[model samples]
Target: MAITSANQLELLQTAEAVAREKMIDPGLVVEAMEESLARAAKSRYGAEMDIRVSIDRKTGKATFTRVRTVVDEEEIENYQAEMTVEQAKQYLEAPEIGDTFVEEIPPVELGRIAAQSAKQVILQKVREAERDRQYEEFKDKAGTIINGLVKREEYGNVIVDIGRGEAVLRRNEKIGRESYRPNDRIRVFIKDVRRETRGPQIFLSRTAPEFMAELFKMEVPEIYDGIIEIKAVARDPGSRAKIAVISYDNSIDPVGACVGMRGSRVQAVVNELQGEKIDIIPWNEDQPTFLVNALQPAEVTKVVLDDEAGKIEVVVPEEQLSLAIGRRGQNVRLASQLTNLDIDIMTEAEESARRQKEFEARTALFQEALDIDEFFAQLLVSEGFANLEEVAYVEIDELLVIDGVDEGTANELQTRAREYLEAAAKAALDAARALGAEDSLIAFEGLTAQMVEALAKDDVKTLEDFATCADWELAGGWTTVDGQRVKDDGVLEPFGVTLEEAQDMVMTARVVLGWVDPEELVAQSEEEAEEGAEEGASEAEA
Candidate 1:
């Protein structure tokens, strides 16, 4: 192949054709051609010579050049490409080190091997440009839905031809054993776009919860218009799904809009999901109320929520137990996911029995600690007294309100309760000391004697050890393992220490030990408060 007048224009024509076919910039193809031609020219000229090629974008004219750089006497390594400053004076009036001298050269007539090598170079560059173009086009399309045609199936994975690129729908991402043949049109959610060495990988999914949300958004005009918002979605893939929605407009019912007139809208989404049943629930700011709505078709007798633990207990009628829990606990599982809380569902009868057991336990505790008779202990338990501390420190009027309890009786009960608590505290402190607990830890505020004993048993016997503990380590927390939340038992958790209280106690210890500056802590807190206030003001203004 020669860069003659006849073939000079052909170079530009071929570059534009390749660029158009690859959907990449024409300048990139031209640059690739220039590089390939330069490589061939180097083969014709000395390999050490710096040969360069340039193509005129407008005139389609090819220009070839030979370049040599002037270097210091000791730096001249390439005899054909580099010359010493003194030797370069023959080619220039004055040539400083690092100065390049360029001379026009005739374009090389590429041999069969050279032409083949140049072709491979151009192809490699074009493929790279194509991959970059594809990546840039689809990166932002992630988290969206796109229509594609199935190309083939490798193992269980299906490859789809999306207009300019091919995406893979992994086996796990398919809904309920969905099988597609070649040319089958499929709707999929672009779950992710990743740029790899080979090319951009567009992962498609039909089982994602967001897939259902996007389907609903496409089907529901109110959701698309932002009048009704999809707050949360939980899906069991092709089995069942729960969607929580809220409506900003009072006149518009979010559930009704999602369900559509005569189930037209929701039916469309259901059909696309291969008959997955959907429960549209109205979103509520209160978690319990929202959970009640989420557990539909079952009557809830009571809902007990432990906000600090992110757990909720739902008591349902015995007849509705199976329905609330669903088949194989699917209903409760989806509800838990929708509400972002751990749910423990029980029958009304079970809840009542548990409550009675708690009452009896509290009554027994009062009888033993206060040295009272069964009847007197029962009376205390019935009046909302759970422990000796409450009975000892409660207002005299609160104890007086109990039946047949006078001022003198209340005084005696307080005295007995306080005496029992002091004895228990003394015993716990003695045990902690026996286990090598230090006085520095014992005198620390906030921690009970029993907490110190618990810490001592766990080998935390000093203030420094206590300060080294993380809040979660001291107050317990939930861990996610294999998609299930597991409970991590904390040392002070049994002592009723909350996570926030544990954090404050640890920070207090650090400050007392001079490990942290109190003034800096105060300044950081104030700065955080100001940032929060500014955010609140901006949101309110918006």
Candidate 2:
């Protein structure tokens, strides 16, 4: 019955006062008024009389308007279509036959039931609006700070008072091992704020990895300046954590800055986090390098990468393995997550054995060539050599001391050794050749023209460049050239280079340049000034 601005304001204030006193949303009370008016209007007028109510926000009041259909009839007073032109003279405008008439019915005219109907309509609309409005106000507040009062603890979950509402702080969200009692004041992060018609569903978490990230941002000034970046973090709440940080400025050591003097900077965060053990490490882009840093306080000797499997194998001294792996592998576990690498820790003894197996395989292959086992034993017995290692690495002069092992035998043994080496090298080169291009040859710098020419041919292209014959071909041994035996002095005195120098060229050529050509006969032939000089000297003597 009261459908005016003044009436709406009074109703709104009344609802606001009620909501404030009870700590409930005022919109809910407004909705109840709207529903009350609707039912009342339906009971007084027919249910077909659609009723609407509007409430003023500034006041605890509302207005209710009743709408009805208009009908034109000769003499019917019900549902009046128009007032006569004579009767409309009260206002400046005169009404026509087809025009509609509108007249304000004062509150005094509406019965008690009609006023009740209006109130119901106003209340229902307010309740619906409250949910939507509340959601908007809180959703943006997620990931922010909030002040809440501990309401009650149901089992272990703590319910909190958030101004006009209550939020649940599940036991897991509580920092450290802290316990909460009813009416205790607590500060919590608005981890998640969700809306339901009943109320908002706020999700609270204290064990998420981001919890540590937020704690650092709160305490560290460097983080706000963009100078420090936390590259990664892994945490086990109330236990231990590992975080990787990097600094844009070289002058600032990222880990050192985060650690602070006597670890004060991180300790602030730790204390807030309730004394969680934290280890800060410098972040590295390189996997091997990053893993080494991640396994800190325990020095690492080597890191083997298996990128496809996303795993790394690290080697530390036997004593440090326990330290690197930590208590029940906690250190390595956190490091793995911090570096995002699956880690397998090993001790030095395991690595040493692996290297030993590799070395023995290579040595056996060397002995197989040139019947080196038998040749070495004979040389050792004659020259008083004890082991194979000495003979294998002996100088040419030392080889000469061994009886029955002349330069010819030495040269043949050396060539066989070179060919065996070439065969072994080809296996490794084959894999590289697949992944390499023509520029692969460009890796060579100090190569000679003769050597490059050998690499140019298809059959000898790669093999010739890798062959170790350059020294002997340039040396004094006479070898059959196309079945034609060509012999010369083995004296390298003319070249002023030793066998060691020749050996160096072969090894370098095979690794850097790929193929090496056999030594070409580079001997310079010179004839005596002839016997004419001798005849003149003889005449002078006579």
Candidate 3:
């Protein structure tokens, strides 16, 4: 089958056959042959040998001529040092000592070496051209999902022939241990395309976290057209996925839009996910509220964050603990990814204990009465009363000077002050339920780590019980609770960062976690610019 004995006749035929099979441009093939013959002459003869090849691809032939010096008589024959007239006429009629003669070499002599060399050059050119075509075709579809047939499988990996070339879908990327046969139809995200030794290689994925997001892109016009945005996504392939969706337009319900009436929109995604569940959670600007919703089917009471530990403590009803954590932490794991937070799910009893201790520390400032209105108290602050304690301690006569203060108001103010006093007692009970302070004051320097450890390690059941920790010693008679150090000494460390820095890190995490929001970031940058401008203007005026 290996034919090495190739001639001018065969070379021409072989070139034509290869051109037809590869469907290469006829002119390009001609250029390839012309260049190859010139190279071959340089390889066989001296570099000075002037070889010219005129290939007529239309006629399927090439004329190769090698020009040589018309030497004097002594050079060709041993008799004399230079050529005579009769000897010179054989090469050229009016030949001088350095004149050149054009001699046509038969193509038959271009055997195994020349033919193999030319074949290699031609194939190389063809491949380069093909890669350019494939690169251009798939470049536009970098973030898109395309359906392709499984061309072949090797070593538990499937190679999908995505029109131009094969894209590999590794075994790990197969959904829920899904299997596929040759020629099976499946959709895959065109994760990447690379110019490889073989050809344009497209890397495909079915289990990538973005697989569902890409499916939504195709199903929802808003996504592709830049209307509704998928902010972040977390997926457990062929099982479930939680996607935090947002919309630029306030009127549009990001979740409802993604989940069409009767679940038609999301159903398309489900099909692509191979029966995996999709939870289109509405994105919230509020982290705590968002975390609560991310862990679905579980009624979360409160969320406590430990930035030092990079952990989130979520408290749900005792009955909802198993559901919140799911079977072997599945629900919490997905929620953690969805919100880009490290979550630790806890029951309400555990959380209540944590909060109760916080209420005890803040004392009379935070109300004890459960019926005390926080909304109204905040409203009072908005009305220019900075201190409820000041209002509570004010005399009735002193209150009369105030705009809204009256006798009835003074009476209500006394009740409000009583509520504040009772809040200390109530907070103790509340803090007792919560073992650690729930979103109250983060443990500061005065607290010792051992004391916090004792509380965390203790079997003190509820926050109500915990809030009553008047003499509830952890191990030794120690009240010293070492706080998680935000920084050490005066130098800033990796963990020693400000809140603004942390927020930026979190925003970056959301991008890597799933879908990105470049526009929102741009708007934020513009707002910052305006504020900076106003500050600069005031400085100039000053």
Point to the candidate with the largest lDDT: 1
lDDT tens digits, residue span 1-542, model 2: 54455566666777788677655678777767756755664555455544555554565444556643333346435433234545545643644555444433223235776665555565446555655656667788777666788888888888888875667778877766788777787767778888776766876666667777777877778876779988898887778898988999999888888877888889988886678889888888997998898888889988999764456889999989989998877888788878876688888899889766655554554456556674464444445543333444567677776666798876665566556556655654553444332333434554333333334432234433434455654333445576233554422313433445655655666644434333321121112334667778997896
User: What tens-digit string does per-residue lDDT give for candidate 1 at 169-217?
Assistant: 9999999988999999999999999999999999999999999999999
Per-residue lDDT of model 3, residues 1-542, tens digit only: 12233344565676667667666554566677677777676666645556777766455466767766556566564222234546768768687877766778654245578868877777777666667767777877876788899888899999888875678888887887788888899888878778777777778888887777878888888888767988899887889888998898888878888998889999988987889988889888888888888998788887887665455888788888898988767788789878767677767777777555544433333234323456544444444444455566666676566565578866776786767655654655455345654322112222223333333445434233333333212111112235111222211122234434434533543444344586878798999999999999998896
After aligning candidate 2 to the native by TM-score, how far in Å is the CA of 431 from where it should be? 31
- In model 1, where do residues sit more than 4 Å from their true spots? 42-51, 66-101, 395-397, 403-412, 436-445, 459-471, 481-483, 501-542
The C-alpha RMSD of each candidate to the native structure, in angstroms, is 3.5, 25.0, 15.8
Worst 10 residues of 3 by lDDT: 483-492
TM-score of 2: 0.54
What are the lDDT scores of the predictions, listed in order? Answer: 0.94, 0.65, 0.66
Ranking by lDDT: 1, 3, 2
